[model samples]
Target: MPAPHSRSASTSVLASGSQVQPIQTPNVPLDRSLLLMSLAEEFFDAAHSIAPSVTLSRTGENVEVYEKLISTGLACLDTALSHVRLAPRVEANIRLRYAGVLYEETENFMEAEIALSKGIALCDRNHYYDLKYAMQLLLAQFMFKKSPKASLKALDSYISNAEAYQHISWVYALRFERAAHSLESSSLTDYHAALQNLRSIAKLAGEQNDRPIYMMASLMEAMAHLKSTGPESMEHAQRAIAAVWAYQLDSDNRIPQLLGLAHILDVACSLRQGNPTVMINKLKLMQTMMDEALRDPTWSTTSNVIAIPINRAQNSSQVVSPDTRTVLGIGNDGRDNLMLSFVSKKDAFSITYLLCGMVFLHRNSTSDQKGFKYLETGLNSLEADMRAPRASSGVLPDCIATLQWRGQIMCYLNCYMAFCAAAITDWATAKGHIEKVETTARDFDVPLVGPLGSVLVYLTGVYYQGIGDLDTALEIFQGKTFELPAETGKTNMMNSADQVERDIALLAALNSLWILQDGDRKNPSRNTTLIARLEPLCKSHPNKDIETAFNLVMATVETHPAAALFQVKNCLRAALNGAQTTANTQFLCITLSVMCNRFFSNVVGAQAEKSAQAASVQAQKSGNILWRSVADGMLAQCYEVNGKAADAKFTRDHAFKLAQMALPDI
Candidate 1:
């Protein structure tokens, strides 16, 4: 058979007297067609540039303008190709551009798929190898949201094709995509495999002098390492930071978006290290970086929105309800519309606000209000983004569009809100927020075994504890168990999700121990049994809060009065130090109340009075009615010990009223 048709091949006819005549095809004027195509490209670029802004605004007027702009571009392409023959390569390029605009700007995905397939067919017929591969990659991206398994299969075939063709860059890109898919898998094994692949890619890219790919791989490696536990994780984080710093120093290689992401990683690293002071300082610096990025016009236009890749595993049997769709901002088409993995400047700002709120809430009573306000501001921004109207649910929104990320962030916001409200004795509001989280978890199909679910479980226990249902709270706390993996003579690093799950379990156990000690003051053996189980776990986990709580429990169960007093004083000193270090007023108040009770029972009137007064003040600052009641009750007993009968009666009545207010049934 003759060679397949080539765009550059010419057809000629032999004529009489050995003369040859060339066959000509009808075509547009080269210059005019070139000018039209160039204009079309400009229109496409402009449309893309303003897409984020349009998503942010979501006004009908803005949407209309965006639609018109893309339509004009498509019209120009049609005019250029009207009744004219163009080279296959040129035609394929134009078709691909048309497909992209359809996919991105118009959100006409079906039409875009048709256009792309046509372009790919043209490339295949003309043996345009490079363009064919590029179109295939684009096709994979398009298929990903609709059918991830199909997309992955297509990507795997492309990776093999790239290798067969010895296309090094394409191979790296394809492998990167594969690794990214693995990273999104729920399996820990897949996650680790992805990390290893990313590290290899970074090393290879650096050796090949592909700076962009190198930077991307390095940054991703750093982010993965940041989610991990142990000293080696910290070392990896530091190395990644240094690498990014080096890249930043090369003015020619500076990327504002990558730099901003690096800054976030740096702050997160501090948080992972549990250094409040360092994390706070880094947060301030990050805020400055974010502000600077917003102020730069070029950055605002070009890099305002960054895509973070994610692929959520969906259950085919469960169809999301209409109400669930609305709550999740999903489109009416029943497609996973919110699966687009994009984060905008507004999203970054809101995330920073969240981090600030979390820090302040943990820091001390003085900053609790500031923390709550920050959380409110962030939550409002996110909610507004979700409420914005979009032309189609299938179209990617301009906000923090990733479903998993958005859902997780909202859960965290609600969880923290519940905690803050409960601290202030707003039981109704606290329960309302908790219920919202449960609703979100159900709507999003968040697995109970996941990090978000673990948090919800722990907080539910806290809610029961706050309401004075000690039995129920104790059961909830004791129901969950976390066991360390058996040592294999190698360091076993836990990822952030696993770490969170384990921490929540530890915290629940600590709560259980507290309940056991409080409820069975005469049964020291029961407390001893629970403490025995907790010590090994706490030693392995090594959390400051766990350690302090364990110490307090052990002190409470001491049988000898003198030894009990000495242990209580030591525990108080430790708690005071922790409160100062972390600025955690709630912990301080709890410890002081316990100390006040100890002193009151010992008939140390003056010491009990001082501890009770201090505990009450701290409780007031924290807005914790439960702890305040405890303080007042202890002070009443101290008054009785000092023979102040009237003072004792009044204080006791006030304490009883506060208890009733905090726990209506009791």
Candidate 2:
């Protein structure tokens, strides 16, 4: 409750006889000024109470009360700012308050920016260091849309201002924001700096007893670590998860979105470490938590932002002076709400659904029949969200930012699903997803040169290859130029040069292998380029096993048939004994196909019989019936070459039957 002020000057009483007497202030100027000051004090007190009420209401799940209280607070701050006698510092704060309130309650960003910029100008003029630092810190949220470079400049200014004011906690918060944006950079120096900044913020937040800040820093740091393909990433992920859970246990009805993000990072970490079981478990938990916290049964009717009528100031057609002040104050409670709200429930749910399907498909191929249902549901949800107006086009920068982020996520969802469908031999469905991915990228004006773009491109090419569109696949792999949307084609921080290059190299080599298999040896220049790319990678790439698969292809196409056979055996060994299913499956089929060719080539010698038998045995052991069919077909060729007509006829019949069985139902 706000402290009450005496209303003697503003209130009047009626006598028992029904005659009313107007209240009068003393004639002395000092006395009259004091009364007016008292009224302003009442308004300020009202403004102060608004934040706590909104916070309490939000945590209590009284969203209607929360909205009303925020509206009331904005009204109070407006009234207070209207007073001519109010102090300059108080007036400036009221303006900043209005900006935040207008932003949070109505999604009126233009109005908010006007209020915030005016507040900053007034604070600068008056030398109100404390208020200026606070307003600048809050301004960082709006700066994200304009320019990261400009936002960093403002944040640095805020940090310096906070230091001058001796507000250490404000400095910590400013640095925390810097750390988050830093993680979005591609530079190693920037990443290392971000990691250090997060560590410092975590420590400072801990010392200041700011658990939410600490937990947020921990999660951000965990995300950074997950991006790293280093040995300590798992340990870092576990530590961050522990920190988030610790906070969750202590806080009642904590933001489920925060925990959901942490679990998402955990799932990524688990995937990198090749632990599908752990990834599945974490994803299920994330799904349950987000569903309980954010699910709306009537999702179709819900707008992601509030639908409030424009206030008087927004409706005004008059061009006002820069000094023109508008009264506004928003409760601090809504900032976190606004932040979390940017991540829609549907986005979270769809991502979780897709991840679950991927884990199922990768770890247990037999479950693909069941898994496709989840994938389809997730895909449908993403497509629906993509088409929804609120998510695709919005009036505010935050809305636009959310739309771009969600668009990127949709691209990834499509890319992954396309690949997974291909892996399960669902060629038609995979091609459908691939076409959507291409169309979405074109429709959304997504960049085609970055890390994600490379993945989508690779997957599209692979889908073409799977469906026997060799010419189209070859054309895509042959092209190096990729387009990005004109406005949002900022250099992608998420997709590093190395990552994009590696995917290109792998795709190019795969194209070359197919071309060679088609007996198109005329294009030696393409093979030359591919050999140059694969040779250095084979010796130094971190995933040596994957590089070896590249090497196997190169050796098969360029070197002796004997050497090609040797490389094939090594890849088969790695796929069987050393590699994760995800990594193994990629080159496993190609390796088997090459091995079958080698076995047929050696049909005249004792090695022919041994090679033929080994190919069939290994293909069956790999649990890939398609490869088994190929193996049997090659063995039949070997038997015919050896004049064993009866054996050849029997083996050819069995191969035909196996090929029929290997076809996907779809």
Best prediction by lDDT: 1
- Model 1 over residues 1-666: C-alpha lDDT tens digits? 011111011111112112311232355333556656866765555554555555555567666655655677788787765644777867877776676656565556687788778888898898766566656766777887677778778887988876666555555656677677766665567667677777766776666565545666777788777666665787787797777677666664455666777788887777666566887798888888888878755344313333221111143112222221211123333332212133556667677777777767666444347777878888888788667643322332433245446666777888888877777777788888889888866654445567777777778888888877888887788774434334322334566777778778777876766666574434566656656666666643434656666666666664322344565688677766666656567777887777767655647557767767787778777677777788888778888888889998998999888888888877
Q: What is the lDDT of candidate 2?
A: 0.58
lDDT agreement of model 1 with the native: 0.65
The list of candidate 1 runs beyond 4 A from truth reads: 1-129, 132-172, 185-215, 247-254, 298-342, 364-368, 391-405, 440-449, 478-493, 517-526, 540-542, 557-577, 605-610, 639-657
The best candidate in terms of TM-score: 1
Against the true structure, candidate 1 reaches a TM-score of: 0.67
* TM-score for each predicted model, relative to the true structure: 0.67, 0.66
lDDT of 2 by residue, 67-181 (tens): 4444554655666666546677667756766776565446666667777788878877886644565567557766765667777777877767665654554455568677777
